[model samples]
Target: MKILIVENEIYLAQSIASKLSHFGFVCEMIPSVGEAMQMEAADIILLSANIPGQDFYPLIEKFKDSIVILMIPYVNEEMVMRPLKAGISDYIVKPFMIDELICKIEHYTAFRQLQKEIAFYRDYFCNSLLMPTYSINTKISFPLIIKSVSQKVIDMCVVNYAIHKKLAINFISLYKNHHYKEIFKSVSKTQLTYIIGFETLRKEEKEECVKALKNIPVIFACLGGDLHDFKNVFEINVKEMTHGFQEDVLSVDEYIKTMILKFEDKYPDTELSKRLGMSRKSLWEKRKKYGITKKK
Candidate 1:
C-alpha cells in the first residue's frame, strides 16, 4: 500500500511515515499539498491542517478520490467540519495515537476494499476484454496447488476466471515437481472446457517439461488434442467451450491466475479443496506451493 503524507512539519511527517512503513505501507512524505498533486498515485494520503489559507483544502479538490487522513491542530467543530465537508476520509486530532492512526488506516483500508468490490461488480467485470469462456468447478472450495499435465486447460481456466473477476491473472503451476498426484481420481468424468487462443509456447527451455510430458501424456494431448498424433495419444472427454474470438490469446500462467481469482470471487466462502471438487487438502497445498498471497 502506497501512502502519501502531506505535512509541513518535517519531523512529524518522518515519524508517521516510519510507523506506517512498519505496517506494510510504502510511505511518501510530501512537504505540501503541491507536492501531493505531483504524485502519480498513492493508496492513502495523510494531510495536516497546520498552516494558514485553507490548508489541505485545495488538494482535496484535486485528489478527492485519494483516501485522506486529516491532522488538525484544533479538535474544535469548524476545523474538523471543513475537511469532512470537503470529503476527507478520516480525522486525527493533534498528538493522537500512532496506534490509533494505524487503526484508522486499517479501518479506511477495509472501507476502501468494500467500495472497490462494489465498483468491481458494477463496472469492471462486464467491461473486461475477456475471451468467452465457461466455468471450472474442481470441487475444492479453497485455492490449492494443483499441477496440470495439460497446459491448454490450465490456460483456459485462468482466462475464464480473470474475465469474471476483472483482475490480471497468471498461472504458475507449470514449474512444479509433481502433477497434483491424486486430483484426477476425483475429476468424476465431467469435462468443463473453455475456448482460448494460442499464445503458443515451447522454447528450448521447455525441453525438460516436454520430456516429463512424454511420461504423463496429457500435456501433449492437451496441446494437440489427438489430431497432431505426435505419439499415439487418444482424445479424452475433457469438456470444451468453443467461441468465435478464441484466436485472441493469453499465456498459461496468466490464464491460471485468472481462473483462480475468479473462482475466489465466485465462491468467496469456497473451501477450494472440497468446493472446487478436489481433495480436501489440495487447495491449501496449492496456495502454499504457489505462495499465492491472500487479499485482505
Candidate 2:
C-alpha cells in the first residue's frame, strides 16, 4: 500500500513513515499539501489540518472523493466535524497511539472503498437502462449492446482497484434493493446466465464461477453458442444441472459477471470436473446410480 502523508512537521512525518514502513507499507512524505497534490496517484493520503499557509479543507476539494484521513494536533466538534463534512474520510487526533491510528486507517479505508464501489454501480445504473429484459424482433441488436456503454464506464472506473480486484464481487451487495423486485413475477426465472458480450473474464476466475456455479446448474452459452445445440442438451437432461431445483433457477442477471473480471490475465477455471470427471457410459450409469430422473 502506498500511503501519502501531507504533514509539514518533519520529525512527525518521519516517525509515522517509519511506523508504517515497519509493516511493509510504502510511505511517501510530502511537507506540504501542495506538493502532495502533484503526486495524485497515492493510494491513501493522510492530511494534517494544522499545516503552514494552507488549510486542509481545499485539499479535500483538490482530491475530492479520495480516501484521505485527516490528522490534527487536537480534535473537537468544530475541527473534526467540518473536515468530515468536507469529504475527509476519517479524522485522527495527534499524540494518539500508533495502534489506534492504524486501526482508524483500516476502518475508514474499508469504508472509503465501499463508498467508491457503490458510487461506481450507481453511475452504472444511471448510464445504463436497468430494463428487466430487452425484447428483440427479427435481426434486432443483441440486448447486451445497449448496455455496453454503461458497463464500460463502470468497469473503467473500477479497473485499477487492486491486484485482485478483478475477483468476483457480488453486485447485489453494491446496489440497494429496488421497490418492485417481484415485478418479474411473470417471467420464468431459470438458470442465471450472464449473457454479456463486451467484457472478458480471466479463464480462471470465470472457471471459479463455474465451480461455484455448481449446486445451481448454471450454463455459459455465449451469444454465438448454438441455441439449438444447447436446447438439445437441455432437453436431454434439464434435471442433471438443476439438481432438482429447475423451477427456481435464479440470478441470470449476474450469470456471466465473472467473465468481466479482467482481460490481461489468462486464468483457467481450476475447479470444474474434468469432462464432468466421468466417461459417457459412466455418467449414464451414475444417473441411474443416483436414481436421477430427466425432466426435459
Candidate 3:
C-alpha cells in the first residue's frame, strides 16, 4: 500500500518513511499540505496537525476517501473531534511508537476491505433475487418454516426478507455436520438465524433441531412437504425453470430439454416447436432423446 506523510518536520517524516518502507510500504514524504495535495493518490495519509499556520482541514477534505490519520501534539476538541467528525480515519499523538501507528494503519485497512466485501456480496445477493417471484408478509411470525420445491427460491425469499427488515442472518445448513445446539447457543439473540436443509435431516435430528431452536427467532427453509409441528409454515412452490441469469452457455441438448419441459404444457407442440425454431417431429425426437415423456 502507498503511504503519504504530510509533515513539515523533514527529519520526522523521513524517519517514518524509512521504517514503513522496510515493512514493504511505498512511502512519499511531503513538507506541506500543498505538496501532499499535488501528489496523485495514496492509500493512507498521515497528516501532522501541528504544522504551524497551516489549515489542515483542506487536506482532510481533499483526501476524505483515503485513510487520513492525524498526528497531533495533544488531543482536544479542535485537534481531534473536529477532524474525526470530518471523516478523519484516526489520530495518533506525537512521539508515538512506529509500531502503534502501523497497527492502526493495518486495522483500518482490514476494516475497509471487510466493508468492500460485504457491499459486494449484498449487491450480488439482491441481484440474484430479482429473477425469482416471492413475497414476504409483514404479519408473518418468526421461528417460521418455509417449505419449497426449490431450495434456491426459499433462499432468495428468506434472504430478501432479512435484507428488507435490516436484519443480519447467520445461515447454517444442516447438510453439513453442524451441531444445532452449539450453533443455537453461539448465535446472537439480536440477529436472525436461518437453519436450512431441514428436510434432509433424519427424524431424530429434526427433533433435536426443534428442541435447539425452540423460542428462538429463526427461519427454517425445508425442502418438500409442510412441517406440521412448526407454528408458522409458509409454502413457496416456484415452478420457474430458470433460476437467474446463466453464467455459462447451456449445451444444445440441455437447452432443448429445459425448453421442452418448461413450455410443453403451456404451449401446443407446434407452437413450442416454432418458438424453439424446430419442427414438431424434431421436438418429439429431442424429448425422446432426453427421456422427457409428456404426461397423458
Best by TM-score: 3
Off by over 4 Å in 1: 123-296
lDDT of 3 by residue, 88-200 (tens): 99999999999999999999999999999989877777776453356565477657788765555677788788877898888876646344455566555668888775654
Tell me the tens digit of each residue's lDDT in model 2 across 1-296: 88888988899999999998987789989998778767857767888888867866667887765678888888788888988788777878887778988897788778878888878765654444321111111232111111222333223222222112332322221012121122123212332222223123233433443344344322222311113311212111223223334432223323223221221124323321133444545544543432222222
Off by over 4 Å in 3: 126-133, 149-152, 178-181, 224-231, 240-296
Best by lDDT: 3
lDDT score of residue 25 within candidate 3: 98
For 116-169, candidate 1 gives per-residue lDDT tens digits of 886775454344443233344443222221233344444445545555555443
The local distance difference test score of model 2 is 0.49
Give, for candidate 1, the lowest lDDT window spanning 10 residues: 192-201
- Ten-residue segment with the worst summed lDDT in candidate 3? 240-249
lDDT of each: 0.55, 0.49, 0.77
TM-scores for all candidates? Answer: 0.43, 0.46, 0.72
Q: Which candidate, 1 or 2, would have the higher lDDT against the true structure?
A: 1
Clashing pairs in 2: 192-252, 193-252, 194-255, 194-256, 200-259, 201-259, 203-267, 204-267, 204-268
